[model samples]
Target: MDTEQQSQTKSEFEREPVPKSALLGFKSFIGMYAGEHCAGTELMLGPLFVAAGVSAFDLIIGLLLGNALAVLSWMFMCAPIATRSRLTLYYQLEKICGRKLVILYNLANGVMFCFLAGAMVTVSATALGVWFRFKMPGLNDLYPNSVGWVVAVAVAGGLIAIVAAYGYQTVAKFANIAAPWMVLVFLVFGFVGLRQFIEATGTEIGSLSDVWHLAKTQIWKGGPPQEGQVKFTFWHVTFFAWFCNMAMHIGMSDLSVFRFARKSWYGVASGAGMYVGHFMAWISASILYAYQLHLNPADTDVLPGPLAYRAAGLVGLLCVIIAGWTTANPTIYRAGLAFQALSPKSSRFKVTLITGAIATIAGMFPAIAMKLLGFVALYGLVLMPMGAVIFVDFWLIRKFGMQSYYAELSGKTFNWAAGLAWFVTLAIAWVLVKFAGVQIFFVSLPGWFVAAILYIVLSKFYQKKLRPDAVQ
Candidate 1:
């Protein structure tokens, strides 16, 4: 089972590839990607689109194009490489970039995963907060507001972490149980909110065009930017949708997920997420927020709990809690794997438990969850260059007369070419954001190309220098 944690006795595949006996079916991937994508973060991200003041046409059209691109990237770029190589991103990177470089990568990957898992925990806490009546963070909140908020987060995060520490089987079972019900709740949110909108506005909405008109004028009105938010356009929506999962697909992080697949075509399974979670769930959640704004324009808080409660009542509330757990559980498990990569001799349970603690502490603060829009963009950008490196090493290095895995072949502790590619590409991305007036959402597209080209070019020079007799 792909979801079950591999046996503890299994090593890092230092000897052979993942056996064919271990490969999983397409349905496994469909469930996994859908569960991961249509999860707690969707609750956070869907409302944010409305906050950005996106138009009906732009938001709708952009998501269509962007999600298609994400699905294609998964099928063509991520899956083939993962299935062919049959190595985890960590093991593969260690081979190409060497142990010293991979250590730094693992540390960064671990922290990023923890913070992301923490955000999901925060989402779960909001459901509890609804019952406890604890102070929840508003849109602009940067810190934990009350002791009730703190305790809610700690308790929520602790439980999520404990489940993750038990390994992938526990995480998988939890997600499978929750995924179907949560997805149903998301759909109910859309329909209930839509009915309310028609009733509230007294509009004669009877056809698709009526819904389209409502989408433009009443819901996503293409208005001026909200206070402390950016105005989103077609390009912004398209790019953000595509790049939101940049680390997982374009950056090869899902190499971990897809490595267990029976066939590369299983990559198409991500469509379950792009359409279900990113499309329907996002639009539905937006309807809930739009309705809230209609009722009380002053209540501009992007809290998912209140929004969901208004739509499906109690079922929605319970769904939010379970959705957040299923989402965070796998992420925490992945983070645990990253931490375990750093100390191969350590037990995964201990490292994962400790990683979960870090996430719980992070959940106490509202900044990570409240600022999720920017944080997700930043997370994808930071991790993307390594993915580009993986791509280039897999396909282009040997064609360029450069030896792949030069660091491993030569017994070096670090590969400067890979390091330089990572650093230089990030520098270029930073320059684009800081000086070129490029938004974070659009920066990774060009940044990916930069990392790919730089890795190939640098490998030629860096490797040749290491082997004086080698030709470029």
Candidate 2:
């Protein structure tokens, strides 16, 4: 190929506008979701269910019902909008919410994305520490346990950031490559852990009741949370499963990913992630934890690196490292885009590097990963409001006889309706959590509805006053 042709091909592959042809078949999404969800972090998140004292029915049935709702939301709500607009969430927000509002959204979105990526960095570093025999943190341990852990995290973070800096194509390619192997590893971890559990208990698998009894007595026994941990009930598990990725699904952040899909059905592919990563992988990882508890009941520290290394040896260790990268890469890329929107002139690659650096720094602090449950819930609540605004603006605005993308059309720098809706919804959700004693998991759903209602009301009022002729 000529120089120009080579450059075009490289650009096409790198930023690839995701052709309608490549928008996706169901299989592509299935693979992507399965791989993306069944990652190393599952090792951490799954065990937390055990810590939270979920009963067998609650853990199994709740995840099934909750994850199904999440998938349906993506298909019915998120994907249709994405297919129609074919724009990144950031760009879409710019049109509806305006540049000023988007800048604030991007900051919040970018910072949250960075913290999430940092947790993945922590996951991969755990594997590195295992390989090098570095000291790892315990469950309650918040600070770095050793210098070796720090260096491992730095090296792993640097590598993940570099992959992310290359942009979306690289992140997607890496995910595609690593996802299959990671899924197998998660499967192996589950199977091996189950065998170990069966052997430890000397229980014969004769009937469903036997399994139920074992699960209740042995596995996810409903009990008080560990010290320094909040108690979790069935509602907590149900809502957490539903809104853990509230920003992506309900908040419409995945518009960037789903915009490439040829049809909305591709949103159904998220079911793979929900079931494989969140459901299956979680159960598997919890099995690992149950085994660990059986072996050492007093041990509170749960690290994926050591856990995997013990189960599948070198292969398991590698899975931990690469699995963490696969998950973090796209996250950092998304974060980079958020930051880049702040300064459209700045190079996305450079901004991504800076974002990666921030993530690396955050990764050094184990507390973020250690508190993954609460952190994930909080992040979703914070970002879900803007998603609600986008949803309402795209689908509901026309019905109200108001213009969609009002900011772009009116040439407004800030859309007070979008801004107030987002902030006010979050403030109300915060109040619910603090004063009303509502569980954090359930807050986002109500918060999203509040934001939607607020956006429509505020938009109608603001537009009527500002552009009276524009309102029907």
Candidate 3:
């Protein structure tokens, strides 16, 4: 192979199983998950929970259970398949869903990734607004409020894309470097916010009970939601915490990440992220936002830049920027892989750079980030059916008297069974959320079972029609 060809092959193990030599140790995933999960979203989500009227008990216990579930899903649902197959989710889907159908899935997956990365960019940009004294968007504000905000997003997103275009090892290295420092900064935010609350409320810090008392009465008071915010209960908090990263864990997007793992058990490293980022970081951030609300009720904006700065000063601002960058880097890399899967001939480096550019453009629009609570729920729901399809195809299809990887075995360009399982499950999810009055956050739970069953039943009929002799 020429030098150029070698570089392209090294871009990612796109069309092939990752060689044994390329497999990563457990620490890499620990760092990556910790850095990625304890990120810009934490700043937004922590605040959003308060906006949604989550009580102290609900937020605390709910996050405990929800994060535990998220780790298990990553361990059992995603990592087993990733380690066994050592293939990217896109490539694995192509084997089962066929080339044409996989293209549709990739497009959806990649676009969602771009928008998500864009939200992170918006988060980082908010930090810049504080320094430059630019007008930032409000909780309900959708469009770019100032030219400075746009420029900030562009700079942050551009740098993130360049790093992502270098590929996975680089992404992991960046995460490792940032994770420890970011974790400490987040802790400081909690302490600073707690001190402010204590001073303002005149609460005596006698014991843990006092802290709980402060948390109950002042921080998360269990009141009605702000205008336009959804009311959140314990179930809502638990489900949101569990399924917030549903796309990455249950939706099987992390197949690309975990495919590099030496053992499926490495999935447990997600706990480092779940506990530190999702649990501690979220509580800390919510503390800052809650303090802001305590001081003034009318100021109902969810801006991380100002929120962090108020807690830790310049250090807090820097944390917000770096946190967003670390998260966006791997996200853009994954999005690039999804896009590259569509046209295997395209260069992943270039595709990633382009993908980052798209995310940057998206970051200029505040709608996705401002309405992040709903958007994250919807993002996971749209992609989650595919995960169910993957789960069934891997573990259940053969037991049901059907051939697995039907598209690959039959040389078909489109596997209608897999395609229908994806689309039909989504259709049912829509019905439940639309007319049946199921919130988007909760719909994905039942939807997963529905997709699994749909895939099995549809595969039985599909295989019988296509290859009668192949069906037992």
- Point to the candidate with the largest TM-score: 1
Q: Which stretches of candidate 1 lie over 4 Å from their true place?
A: 1-15, 19-22, 166-168, 345-349, 465-472
lDDT, ranked from best to worst: 3, 1, 2
Q: Scored by CA lDDT, what does every candidate get?
A: 0.85, 0.82, 0.88
lDDT of 3 at 120: 95
RMSD values for the candidates in order, in angstroms, are 2.7, 3.8, 3.8
Candidate 1, residues 227-324: lDDT per residue as tens digits? 87778899988988888899899999888778778899888999989999999999999889888888998888888888888788898888888888
**Once superposed on the true structure, which residue ranges of model 2 sit more than 4 Å away at CA?**
1-23, 166-172, 465-472
**Which window of ten consecutive residues has the lowest lDDT sum in model 1?**
1-10
Using alpha carbons, what is the TM-score of model 1? 0.93
Which candidate wins on lDDT?
3
Q: Single out the weakest 10-residue window by summed lDDT for candidate 3.
A: 1-10
Per-residue lDDT over 109-195 for candidate 2, one digit per residue giving the tens place of the 0 to 100 score: 889989999999999998887768878877777788789988988899998888778755666666676777788889999888877
TM-score of 2: 0.90
**By the TM-score metric, which is better: model 1 or model 3?**
1
Give candidate 3 regions above 4 Å deviation. Answer: 1-25, 158-172, 259-263, 344-350, 465-472
Return the TM-score for each candidate structure.
0.93, 0.90, 0.90
